[model samples]
Target: MITTRDATKNDIDTLFDLILGIAKFHNQEEYVLTNKEEMLNSGFNNEPKFGAIIADFNSKVAGYLSYTWNYSIWNGCEYMNLDDLFVWEEFRGQKVGLMLMEHAKNICKEKNISLIRWEVEKDNVKAIEFYNRLGAKITEKGIFRWHLNASN
Candidate 1:
């Protein structure tokens, strides 16, 4: 049986492991060890800008969905941005991802959030199809990200 719940401080180490697993699965292993402490602090500290919903199978955490809230000036409402949704390889086909999504939807419903948005790699056809199946539409608009640093 699979159960889902919001993550707490006690789950940090497990969450860290799951994040590394996802990075490895995505072939972005370099990111696996990046900012480990800060990331954990951000997600599990007293004031968190992000939140996570984790899936537990039997007694082990098998997946997680991490997200943050964004404000859309045009819509003038809070939009939930799903940063990452990952299920362990052994648990992939078990509807864990969908369960996390539904949980996020319920959160938005209660918070009066208007929309949920996420970006997927253009080459990830599998994910595109999955989102489409969930009635999520692809917009003609593109997202541009800029990192403000001393070099810039």
Candidate 2:
């Protein structure tokens, strides 16, 4: 069985591990800049920057889902940005990812969030199919980014 709970200060190490896992899975490990301290402060602080849920299977860590609240002028209420949803390889095909998504949906329902947004790597075909099965629309809008630094 899979169970989930809100990530706490004590889970920072595991959370960071999961983050690294996802990055490595995507072959983007170089972009994982934050560490456990940053994760703790960002998610467990008085004014949190993000929220995360940890998934466990049979008392072992299985996965995690992280999100942030964002506002849109187009929509009057707040929405959630699903930053990451990763299931450990050993736990894949066992519905851990589905449970994590269900948990996120319930959280949004409680918060009155009508939308949840996330970007997947273009080459992640399996994830694309999963999102499609969940009825998420794929928009043609392109995502752009800039890696900025103070020294730049």
Candidate 3:
């Protein structure tokens, strides 16, 4: 059976491995790849700023999700930004993803978050379908990003 629970310090190494697998799967550029040490600092630091959940199946980690809360002026309430949702290749079709999402929903309810948000690559049809199946709608607006450089 698959079960989902919040990730703790003990799951850091396993979560790091899964993150690397996701980074490789997406073929992200080196500059954008997530580093294990940085993740540890951000998630397990004195004042951790992010939260994660792991999907455990028969005592093994099969998938995980990381999220943070964001405020929206338009909504006037806090919403959850699902930063990452990844499942192992072998567990793709097994409901590990669903279990992770359910976990997120529970957190949102507990935290009084108004909504959950995430971005998916345009070409990832499978992911789009999965999100839709989960009752997620694609906003018809574009997302803008600005990268800041230290040299400024």
RMSD of each: 1.8, 1.2, 1.7
Regions of candidate 3 where Cα sits further than 4 Å from its true position: 32-34
Lowest lDDT sum, 10 consecutive residues, model 1, at 31-40
CA shift of 59, model 2, Å: 1.0
RMSD of 2: 1.2
Candidate lDDT scores, in order, read 0.85, 0.91, 0.86
Tell how far residue 114 is off in model 3, in angstroms. 2.4
**Model 1 TM-score (2 dp):** 0.89
TM-score of each: 0.89, 0.95, 0.90
- Candidate 3 minimal-lDDT segment of 10 residues: 28-37
lDDT of 3 by residue, 1-152 (tens): 99898888878888888777777789863645556677788888788889999998888789999888789999898999998899988889888999999999999999877599998888889889999999999976688988789976
Model 3: pairs clashing at backbone N, Cα or C within 3 Å: none
Q: Measured by TM-score, how close is model 2 to the native structure?
A: 0.95
Ranking by lDDT, best first? Answer: 2, 3, 1
TM-score of 3: 0.90
